[model samples]
Structure formats: C-alpha cells, structure tokens
Target: MPKLIKDGRVVDDQWQGEILQPEQIPESPAAPVAVQLEPGQGPATIPCALSNLGLVTIFFPAFTDGRCFSYARELRESGYTGEIRATGHFIRDQLFYLQRCGFNAFQFAEEVDLDACLASLSDFSESYQAAVDQPEPLFLRR
Candidate 1:
C-alpha cells in the first residue's frame, strides 16, 4: 500500500477508489470514483461533477510545474469539499503552500523521508496571502 501524508500525519493510504481518466467512467463503479487530473488539465474539466467524486488526485509531472497549485485552489474555490490529493513529483518544500491551496492529502512519487516532509509542512507559521485554508489575508487578520 502507498503511504500518504493526510491531515498532518503519515499513514497508509486508505483510498479504495479507483482513479480513472475523465472518459473512463464505469457504468457501475464498484468502488468510489476518483479522477486523475494531469498537469495540463483545467480544474474546471470536472466542475459540474465535483460533488460526485470521492477524491481528485492531481499529478505534478515535475516540481517545476506549479499549475497543480492553482488547480487545487480552484477546486476548493469551486466548492469541492472532498479530498484534493497532490500526487507525483512534488517536493517537501511545497507541502506548506500545497496545504494553503487546500490540498489535504499528499502522495509523493519519489522516496522521500516522510518525517522530514511532515516537519516541512510547518515551515512557516503563517502565510501572507488569502488562500483556500486561510480566507483572511495577513493584513486583514492584523
């Protein structure tokens, strides 16, 4: 089983859903439905059906591709209350920002030290801008 950082802890991924491509929806999906969103895919591609999914796994082909960061924010802005998991290629340094963008779960493609990654999540005690997790910007909070 794959390990993931969920809700601030490293644990075995309990997702039983099958992450299928946008067009591969089964007539009767036995398990919960999860969508695999690629780097170039628009967050709106699954807009109308956000509530129907059990999870939305956004793949970061590389750490340099920051598009997934926007996708996670957009998904949250669009009212996707379910889990928005960041998987593939992202580094631990981005974890804090990823969480600010509403990514509650993370699964790295590489073999990184989970403990170090978990610690990195708290690298900063606060953020300056408004985000999915923090609606009020720092100025507004002051």
Candidate 2:
C-alpha cells in the first residue's frame, strides 16, 4: 500500500474512482473517491456529482495544464465540503499552491520524500492572498 502524509502524519492511502456516468458511484461508505477529467471538460458538469459522492480526488493528467486547479477552487466555492485531492504528475513544489486551491490531499506519480514535501507545506510563514482553504485570504492577516 502506498503511504500519504496527511495532516502531518503518514498513513495508508485509499481512494475510489467516480466514473463519468452518474450511476457509477454507489451510496455505500467507501474509500475517498477520485474523479478524472479529460481535457476541456467543464467543472460545472461534474462537481455536484463528485460532492455528493463524498471524498473526491481530481486528476491533472499533466502538471502544466492547470484547469483542474480552477476546478478545485470552484468546487469549494460552490459548497462541496468533502476532501479534495490532487493526483498525477504533481510536484512537491505544487503542494502549498494546491492546498491554497483547496486540495487537502495529493497522490504524486512516484515515491517522494514525504517528510520534505510535508515540510514544504509551510515553507513560507505568510501568503499574500486568501485561497479556498484559507478563508481569511492572506491579505487580511495582521
């Protein structure tokens, strides 16, 4: 089993997938679920469905394409309160930004130095703007 460092602790990771079809996700309580989006797919079409399924993992097929980041923020803004995750080709440097964008968990493509990446979450003690996960928006901090 792969290990993920979440909330500063290392633990076994579990994730379920939500197929594009509406009927694919079941109601039973299960592992955190992941949702995959093809290029150009609109977030509006799927967020509601993913939210209803409980935990959700959003995949970014490539690191350069950032549409998923916007999708995650929009999901949070629209009132989806479950766990949001980032998976696939994600880099350690992207963690803080992903967190700011509302991704609470990440599944990188390869084994990483978990401790180093976890430390990077707070590499900067301050931020300039409020993000989905930070309600105060960094600018309001005194």
RMSD of each: 2.1, 3.5
lDDT of 2 by residue, 5-94 (tens): 565555678653444432343554354344454347645555344545555567778888788888788878878777676767778888
The TM-score, computed over Cα atoms with residue i paired to residue i, of candidate 2 is: 0.78
Count clashing residue pairs in model 2: 3
Clash count of each predicted structure: 0, 3
- Cα error, candidate 2, residue 104 (Å): 0.4
Q: Residue 106 deviation, candidate 2, in Å?
A: 0.7
lDDT of each: 0.85, 0.68
